[model samples]
Target: QQQVKQSPQSLIVQKGGISIINCAYENTAFDYFPWYQQFPGKGPALLIAIRPDVSEKKEGRFTISFNKSAKQFSLHIMDSQPGDSATYFCAASQQTSNYQLIWGAGTKLIIKP
Candidate 1:
């Protein structure tokens, strides 16, 4: 499995500010990379995802709009709030690699009041 590099080991975002997390992978064989958000005392949950062919995907305030050509992806949190503070992870997987995913070193996001 190829490693996915995520930037900004930690992030501090003010309320209503935009929080952006970035990730890049070297394996072009990796089909899709998904962003997961884990709140305290809770397991990680899928926030959003982008298909290999698609450049972007958005849901509510979270976006996984990506640059497939560069094998880079991002999660954008618009109107960030304290409630949004959590550990965010980016994961990559290959079609033939079964369900096993290569995870990025997560970024701890703090949305300040």
Candidate 2:
């Protein structure tokens, strides 16, 4: 329940397309969910997040949809761009943990021109 596991390792999307990836967790105690975006060797930056209180959250081109009962969540990118090509990670943590993050293995996204 403490780990968020992602899949596909990598994804390729054409410009202006949509990208989607899934994640699941075993720990129901986790309440905070966040998605991060990283470019190259840069540190992951928080892209968007949703808590158990909300079913979804969106920021600009990035969106995170959550399912509390299912213990799953997903990240969706709309209008994929070359600049948006980067690694994405999903994370989980409890507020009581002081927001310490449990990260998913990074997913490399490539937006082909």
Candidate 3:
């Protein structure tokens, strides 16, 4: 079974709008949750991450809200711009097995002008 699940395979937002992506995990052992953003040719880059100890984290226009009890997390982008259009992925990792990350099917976001 897939350890992590994400919703809304694709999304479209107007410029200066908000974009949201959500994820859920089945593995309770997962302690590290991270979001990645990738362009067409470049490798995925870490956008933000949160540990079980924190409920939410925000950096600039990006925010990550986590619900430990629900084993779920969501990423929110505020004031999304055209440049923000990209594929976003949610991942979970634990201390076991060298902390290998279990990836979720990515969400492709398109920001319209």
Candidate 4:
């Protein structure tokens, strides 16, 4: 079984600051990396992500980057706000795995005003 390891079990960011979360995968077979954000009382929502082929992706205040050589990917929340406080997860998926995502442990992020 493949595994995705994430760093920073928890994080604190000031409002308007950038929040970064990282994930590393063992198997190169993994092709896609997606970032998800979960609120205190809501299910996870797809934040941003992309295939490793692109190397990087950016949407609004969020960005996802892939490093093929390092077998790693990361999520960056730009100008993070208080509303951005949530639990973040990094997941890797492969077509061969029936699109089942192997998830990282998760990071709890808090944004201060």
lDDT for each residue of candidate 4 in 29-52, tens digit (9 for 90 to 100): 888899999999899999887997
Error of 1 at 14 (Å): 0.5
Candidate 3, clashing residue pairs?
A: none
| Residue pairs with backbone overlap in model 2 | 1-26, 1-27
lDDT per model vs. reference: 0.90, 0.89, 0.95, 0.93
Q: Whose TM-score is higher: candidate 2's or candidate 3's?
A: 3
TM-score of 3: 0.97
* Candidate 2 lDDT, 42-84, residue by residue in tens: 8988888888899988888888888888888999999999999
After superposition, the stretches of candidate 1 with alpha carbons farther than 4 Å from their true spots are none
> Model 1 shows how many backbone clashes?
1
* Tens-digit lDDT string for candidate 1 (1-113): 38899988999999999999999999888887889999999999988877788887889988887888878899999999899999999999988889578999999999999
Which ranges of candidate 3 are over 4 A from the true structure?
none
Residue-pair clashes per prediction, in order, are 1, 2, 0, 0
Task: Say which candidate scores most in lDDT.
Answer: 3
Residues 1-113 of candidate 3: C-alpha lDDT, one tens digit per residue: 33799988999999999999999998888989999999999999999999999999999999999999999999999999999999999999989758999999999999999
Candidates sorted on TM-score, descending: 4, 3, 1, 2
